[model samples]
Target: MSQLDPYGNQTPNRAPDSWVPDPWLDQPDREPAGEWPTRNGRADEPYTGSGDLPYSEAEAQTAAYPQVQPRAEADAEPATDPVRPRRPGPGKRRATGRAGRNLPAAIGVGVTLGAVVIASLFVWRPAFLAVIVVALGVAIWEMSRAVRAVGAHPPAVPLAAGGLVTIGMAWYAGEDALMLGFLVTLLATLVWRLADGLSGFGRDAAAATLIAVYVPFLGGFAALLAEPDDGARRVIVTLAAVVLSDTGGYVAGVFFGKRPMAPTISPKKSWEGLAGSLVATAVGSAILLYLLLDVEPWWGAVFGLALSIASVLGDLAESMLKRDLGIKDMSNLLPGHGGLMDRLDSILFALPTAYLLLAVFT
Candidate 1:
């Protein structure tokens, strides 16, 4: 049956399966989408998308019409609209943690570093001392950069040289030599700062002093651990406690962290994580002390608890420093760890705790 279109033209008779022009895609001046040829070779009426019809109603009319299959386009790959990267639809989005932190790589590097350090400790005292010197150099370098953020420029050369001397003396000469090295580093830093002509001399000198004490003086305590008969065992216990504390905190925080331990300085740190760290370190320290060093389990337990606290303190201290300086990680040297200083932050405090424990126990 012939029917009248909106334009009042008689529509041609056609088969039920014959395709019609889609009005939805048609333009005012151009033909409608997909017009078919009539039986006598004239084109069927083009659907005009114009008119006062509602957009939804026009879409409904288009749906009622079927599109004709063209031979050329048929052989072509289905024209898939480009898969654009999707912006998430409106609603609350998923929460994301610290991005790009490669935990597995960090763990692997930590294990490898620990193995190397333990090996060096037993292989030769000088080798271990060298290792300490190298580590101190890296840490001091990182700190030197950190202080600059606050407009303080410490003397790097004097500080690094003094750090090496401090680490060496702690192992070879004793605590007294280590102290002397620290004092000399301070004097040298002050003298070096004087050359810059008093603009920020006080700030620079003070920062240098901090660098001297923080990197080498405090770190020198690790060398003293080697002074005892089973120094390597003591070193191992110290490291194990700190490492266990960190690992426990991370694992627990991931699974069960609720309350933030420090909201401003380190937002991710949680009380639950700290508790996990303490418990794990306590147990681990006791085992290492009793089995490895053959020390009394009670003493091991005390050392564990103490070192765990020390480790947390060290981590917090570093976080505070970073927050003050407005920096995230110390550097990008280590993939998961951030930088050398990041890894050393907790151990710096743990070293002194180990030395104290050794002094008391021995």
Candidate 2:
């Protein structure tokens, strides 16, 4: 009996079910009090460890789990796979193509503008002048920005101010009034630049004066057309002829444009395109005179030749400005057309030529 009950041969201190008792509460009298606490649903098993937070089996199990990283962050890091170097290529650009990426939008805007101008011409004529004046103001603003890129800070405010006055004078008082107003605007522009002191006065004043005269002064001719008899018809015919010329030029240039016309100024422009334009202009002028304005076809031919030559000069003038400033377009506002400056280039010269021809004929 003493051999079996020896102190060295003690049995494992466990429950009758072979569950090893917690080593913490080693007293033989104390059983696991909250070990199987399912019925009461609350285990108030006080942690006897040196921690402020009470130990919970559920919390401990949750904290013990391994954490997984998100794929988004993993992907954001530099890729591990071998990368093939990109070959040397063309310079990065926001847009490309001859016409434009947003051609539909461009066409829609152009159509809308044409509709608005025609509606204004007969219904409320002064509104047409107002629209033109506003457009000139925007052009003045764009010109200032372009010149600024080339280190000239022109006073756009005075220039815009003068443009509005010049347009208004041309509409009410005629060509003489337009000239007087333009002179006043240039004087005002020069005076306005005085406020800027001696710094860049010459360049700024000159630029402001130019902006006022070039856009608004030349544009005043179109307003003068509104003063003559059947003015709306005259303006419409002029617009139609110019538009036809531009269209013909574009069509010819695209298909049969092998040789450049003035490669130094505009590489895309071709002599073939100019020839097409002259043909279209001649036809359009005859129709405008005989059917629309009741003028002789011979006179129309003369007008076509003069206006076509002027139109080429007009386009080249704008291109020269762009080339000098080292810019491709004045603005990206007109989508496929470029900017207001680009659209008005041909029309600016055409309007003046038409006015001069009309004065001679009358």
Candidate 3:
């Protein structure tokens, strides 16, 4: 057998003809056991001889084992690792698919129910109007709540007094009496504002008073629709025209709306919808007049056109009020809809116009 030299070279003293060099030790530049080159070139190899270097028994054991790479370094190897999955954010969970469908369904149901109730009031006049009166009062309270929410301090005394007076005059008095009551309420609002030392008193008072009259006072005409003779028919026909107009506008707007009708006031409205509303109202009113009132188709067309235009203005007026107050809806009293004020907003102008027309022509 051949003996190996310190550098693993074959020695001639022992069986040099039969010597077999170890493959690992045969490489001259390769590091030996317990030996590694120093990074700073201070030491070429680790000293394993007795007392040749300061090292503990554990360090000696570690030196005998192979060094392992850190987990971070191992993980960075692209072939051995899979990509991490991304986590979802908070907003991702709040996405809803039913909002669009649900909103329209809610509005449709609410309007149908409201129309049914209004029609019933025509059958049971006293009881129905009483309910409407109570509803109006509640609506006023809701408006007051909304006003306060936007940081406006309204005079409660004048608001309540004006609301009651308006309701009373509407119930018992004629048109002149109703107008006089409105004037009195306006004066009361001003006085109350002055007593409270509130700034923007004029504007606030005017707004509050108008809200009462616009919501309930105009609603009083629904009661007058039940008068004997053809009065009820005329009122019902007018209401039918308004309803048809609204339905036409909503359907057309959804399908063919292109140009905005009133972008600043109502962003969703379209000229297409407005035109549809006018045509539908005119046609519907003509049919009602021919069938119910024995009136000429031309007269019906004129009334319908006028009422449809008025309804658009009514809608815009309410939009302006809501925009000024920084509110989207008046109240959430009605499911999927808003408060009585919201439902009655379009009817407000329509009712008064119908009443005036009837007073003059009928």
Candidate 4:
């Protein structure tokens, strides 16, 4: 016998025990007809076995309805749509912290720099001055470019020329000449920016003056340190103490840093790392001062403590400046170290501090 289905198509009626399997039913991947909308706009109810159906109720349900998934399996499925964005896997994201840097390259560059500095200090003091001049020039150039990125047009020519004069005067002439060089530089900067019209003259002149003071003016103290007898030892002690602070901070920060020092400006710095720097710098400076300069251990500790704090301040200050300027590094001139300014920042801040303390105590 043949009967009409809900869709008005003919459906065969056979003995329940002798019915053959439908082709659609054999393919479990396809949705069953009962799930489709009917003429009344409702999904057809589960097939419990209609009056004219040839199959038993269990067979009807099994062949015409989807099976209920287990509770665990259903819960295990993803809640979000497959098309939505997901968190990047490890391979997709940047590696951070110590693991992210090229440690070997950084170490190599550091060692090479240290060797050059030590040799310059020992060979001839004036040679060291030349090195400082070259470094300050690069640092000034970097600072000029960085400030210019933010619409400030610091005159690099005057800044560099004045820096050479300032540093050379501090070395050969004295403190008075250093002051004169700085004043002249500031004047030149003001005059140079005036040539560009008064549009941003003050802003441009201010930036150039800051570069002069921040880089060459402070750096002149290094030349002063080299002027005294046993000057090389003093310079070495200062450089060594700062290096020890940085090294200790890096090591401790990588292993044990928990709380951020300044999350907004410098996310990587930590109070614990600062403590490490202080302790290491204090001990290292004390030993160097006592053995080399014949200074009392206590005074050396004081000097070290002061320099460590100054270095920290310098680091944070540069971090704030970079954040304001929207830059990661001043430049990528140095493969692992970022730029001359990045490496010089701490040293520049520490230089005057070291010089004054040594003069007072020794």
Q: Candidate 1, residue 297: CA error in Å?
A: 1.2
- The parts of candidate 4 lying over 4 Å away from their true place are 1-99
Question: How do the residues 329-361 of candidate 4 rate in per-residue lDDT, one tens digit apiece?
Answer: 999988677988988889999999998899898
Report lDDT (CA) for all predictions: 0.84, 0.79, 0.71, 0.85
Comparing 1 with 4 on lDDT, the higher-scoring candidate is 4
User: Per-residue lDDT of 1-362 in model 2, one digit per residue for the tens?
Assistant: 12212234546553456545444444344337757344346555545443334436656766899866688876697768878987657743334335444556667777988898899898998788877887888788788888887788877777888788889999999978999999988887788778879899988877787687679988888899877768888788778778878877888888888889999998889999998888888888887877777889988877777788888888999999899999988898876667888878888889999998977865
Candidate order by decreasing TM-score: 1, 4, 2, 3
Q: TM-scores across all candidates?
A: 0.74, 0.72, 0.70, 0.74
Report how far off residue 292 is in candidate 3 (Å): 1.9
As for TM-score, the candidate ahead, 2 or 4, is: 4
Please identify model 3 stretches exceeding 4 Å from their true place. Answer: 1-112, 115-122, 198-200, 223-228
The superposed Cα distance between candidate 1 and the true structure at residue 149, in angstroms, equals 1.5
**Local accuracy of candidate 3 as per-residue lDDT tens digits, 1-362:** 45667686766667656556655556445456346554444444444343345344445778899898899987695675677887787754433212232465466766776676667556765665566567677777777777775566666567666766666676566566666766777677678778867677766776676665776567666555544456557667877878888888888887899999789989888999999999999998888887887778888887888889888888888888899888878887775556767766787789888877656655
- After superposition on all C-alphas, the RMSD of every candidate to the true structure, in Å, is 14.5, 12.5, 10.2, 12.5
> Candidate 2, after superposition: displacement of residue 202 in Å?
1.9
Per-residue lDDT value at 90 in model 3:
72
Clashing pairs in 1: none
Q: lDDT by residue for model 1 over 1-362, one digit each (tens)?
A: 67665566877784546646557544446545355434344445443445554445555688899877798887789868898887887764443335347757776888889988988988876678778888889999999998899999998988898788878887888889989988988898789779879898888888998888789999999889877778888888889999899888888888999999999988889999999998899888888899988888888888889998999999999999999999989998887778899999999999988898868875
Model 3 scores a TM of: 0.70
